[model samples]
Target chain A: MATKASRAAARMMIAPSVILLLAWMIVPLSLTIYFSFLRYNLITPTGNPFVGWENYYWFVTDPSFQAAMLNTLMLVGGVLLITVAGGIMFALLLDRPMFGQGIIRIMVIAPFFVMPTVSALVWKNMFMNPVNGMFGQIATSLGFQPIDFMGQIPLLSIILIVSWMWLPFATLILFTAMQSLDQEQLEAAEMDGAGSFSRFVFIVLPHLARAITVVILIQTIFHLSIFAEILVTTNGGPGTASTNLTYLIYVSSLLQFDVGLGSAGGVIAIILANIVAIFLMRMIGKNLDA
Target chain B: MARAVSNRTRALNTAVAGTLGFLMFFPILWIFILSFKTEEDAIRAPLEVLFGSGWTLDSFFTVQERSDYFKHFANSVIISLGSTFVGLLIAIPAAWAMAFVPARHTKNVLMWMLSTKMLPPVGVLVPIYLIFRDYGLLDTRIGLVIVLTLMNLPIIIWMLYTYFKEIPGEILEAARMDGASLREEILHVLTPMAIPGMASTVLLNIILAWNEAFWTLNLTAANAAPLTAFIASYSSPEGLFYAKLSAASIMAIAPILIMGWFSQRQLVRGLTFGAVK
Candidate 1:
């Protein structure tokens, strides 16, 4: 048991981290909230007079806003769909007794370690280039015209790249969780004449429910602000085809120098992230006690 | 695992899973191969590039020569390691305090810290950019170190707390009963035990900060750019130089890739905040 003196010392020890994180969250965030209310433009910095929700009005009503909102949802949802489903399949496959299990796992998990910028650039140029990309060579050899992947299907192309990066993460988590499955129970069910499909549906899937939820919520949080892939591959272009909320705000604030509008978009992004954060926090918090 | 598995079934599993794994790893493997070829050979049809191209180290040399690659490499090293060490310094005492002397509000404090991590970086981009501009911290490695340190502190604390929780408290109690001071107990008895957890935490944090793209991209231009920013410059027309781009990418990712393989187990535990484990 901690004595009174030790408790005091504990408080002292914990102060720096608590204070720094508090300020880290509070200072810039409050400034963002403050700037969102003003008509601040870096180009015309004569005055940043407070404009009551005008930035929000313009931001939300902008046609690109609708597209960006949809794109963000699609990117996050598509990645989640692919990663979760692919992760489950990979986890199941890897769970089976296979040859070179260690090497197979290392190969499967390698993509997640590649920096986002490297992965994006490599995929864009090496694999996706219409004329010279590997896919192009394959298509041309097969007598089909090569499709410019980033140009023709920017969002889908972005999704494919992002899914490659994340599939490893989802698989690694699900696979780890799968290792904890009750093998005797599975064997018993098999002996009771349950088919493999029924065994998976009744037993394995239920066990992985928590890990799957963790994967989705965590991936959603990261996916909502995917910046590097879009910047490198698409630059949110082909007429804003792949522009998501994060890139939209990036363009407005940094590129266009519309601090007010960008800050407003930033606020909206924060709100959207908070909705997911609530669920994630609840899940992880429950685990803290366990 | 104890039960008998047929050779046919094992072979089939190998075939299916190996194919999938190769597909998953194809991009990296392809790039690795491309990095060793001439630019002319790299863009040729896949079969020719694989079978016909003469291997060369020219691209790697050109990539290093044309760009100041090592400058960015050094920046990546400093920023990731600097931030991790700084974060660990701040987090160790806090995590220890919370783990060993948790009070009524410890859980809420932890949950609040995690909630801060959930705050999207974009939400505060404007102010942070402006502040960095005014303070002349923009494009500075120290600025990134500070930002990333704050960004990763919560996870560091949470991870250390989880690891510390696993070390039985009764040992400390026994030491205290033996007339050991609290400092002595921690330094003599606890520090050695905590090293492995701390090392893994350091490893995972380094991997994260090394690959961190958002702030590294936005905050830095040339002076403090890391490999993420450096490699991003290839997004220009130069990206068409397949051999050179592949070479650059391979160099950038290779170190982290090796570290990642070693940390795969810790990666799951670290990212999930011990939720699944």
Candidate 2:
């Protein structure tokens, strides 16, 4: 609430953004919620019967639902692990005042900036080609037949490529956290005769606790919707070997043209995303309090 | 004493950092070299391909002929910049209200906005696609812009709000006390103080909006397709065009890749701001 002058000011200030965000949030979302309750399909007219929760029931009962769920969890879990672990190590290296640090950072960060479609394509062809990819070439040079990254280990290949793309982001965020660590605290710990591991565990990790949480939550939300890599590299294929929830929806709705089932799957994905969001919000809430 | 310790540790650090650098950089460097090589050389041994063969631009030519690079580029520029501009226009005022006024629900509201981001787009893809069709937004730049802006709005607002919070409330209050119009306060004072933060936020959001693929691919068929869609087309029905695809990938990613390269410090600074502090 504002005084007459201030209220007008506040309203005026906020009106444009409020309207835009309102439109942004309201239109598509309400349509989604509406569609979730109906038997709608792109191939059919919009006048289809309102099948209350049948779409949801159909979606929940599908065989692919469990696989997609598991795949989503696995990809998020796997990518997060690789990124957080690699991020920590790389951040440690980057935080140090070493030779050519600037140039090295530019190189390390290039992948994160590369268009995902392009990077996925690059990995699909130049690196993971299996016939003439760099990986295949390396394998043949070592006197072994090239293993098809997409065919032999489809999900793992996607996971590795996605992880490679995000690891730099993790490192960048964590490295900033590491740099902001209090030198005085470190010296005090050292004065108390703490070893390197002790200092890292007690001092550095504690200092990084917030950043770590931020990294986990932010990366979790984004990685759960991993689409471009699957589309580019595997097409959710080698027989649904790489289909996560997102790809499943795409296949169901676009490829298979089943909007009812796809909408249901989409609702499930939102619920799963909300679970993560709730956990993140609690962390943010707790942080705000402290 | 710490200087001497830093010096002593520097050598070991350099060795570790060097290896990490090389491993991290190898793929990008390899792709860079491949972008210039003929299809034949691109498939050769890494050692010889790196040193043995003279580079050619045939792949680039093939890419140019196949994909209209400029149309895709224009689409990317329009979508990314449009989203950022639209996002900021809305965010600035909303952030101003919360930052200046003591609203009880401001935190909850902010959290709610961000939570929308966590909702997987796939979950709502069907509905959104339907809505776009019903509204005649499909295969239109406006549809891409609105979706991208919405998709990115939560983070944009969060980033802008965080920056806005840093400006001392006393200043905004003083502007109120001075009878400076809210417009004056925002345009004349608040914006200037926060432009650096806002500029970084704008650049970072452009990058996020630029790299977005799911919505662009899903919502767009042909008319509104961006660089991501451009690259996606190269993975064909008969087989993947490995060499030409790389060149197309190179062409598609080069603009934003270069943008990111130039604006690394700013992007990282904005992304890592609150967590670091």
Each prediction's DockQ against the real complex: 0.84, 0.60
Per-residue alpha-carbon lDDT of model 2 for B115-145, expressed as tens digits? 6676788877877787788899998899999
| lDDT tens digits by residue: candidate 1, A128-150 | 98988888889999999998999
Give candidate 1 misplaced runs (Cα > 4 Å): none
| Cα-based TM-score, every candidate | 0.99, 0.93
Query: Which is the leading candidate under lDDT?
Result: 1
True contacts kept of each: 0.89, 0.67
Model 2: residues with Cα > 4 Å off, grouped in runs? A1-4, A44-47, A286-290, B6-8, B172-179, B237-240, B262-276
- The residue pairs that clash in candidate 2, if any, are A17-B90, A266-B123
Each model's lDDT comes to 0.94, 0.79
Task: Kindly list the per-residue Cα lDDT of model 1 for residues B35-131, writing each as its tens digit.
Answer: 9999889889888988987999999899889887899999999999999999999999999999999898999999999999999999999999999
Best by TM-score: 1
The native-contact fraction of candidate 1 is 0.89
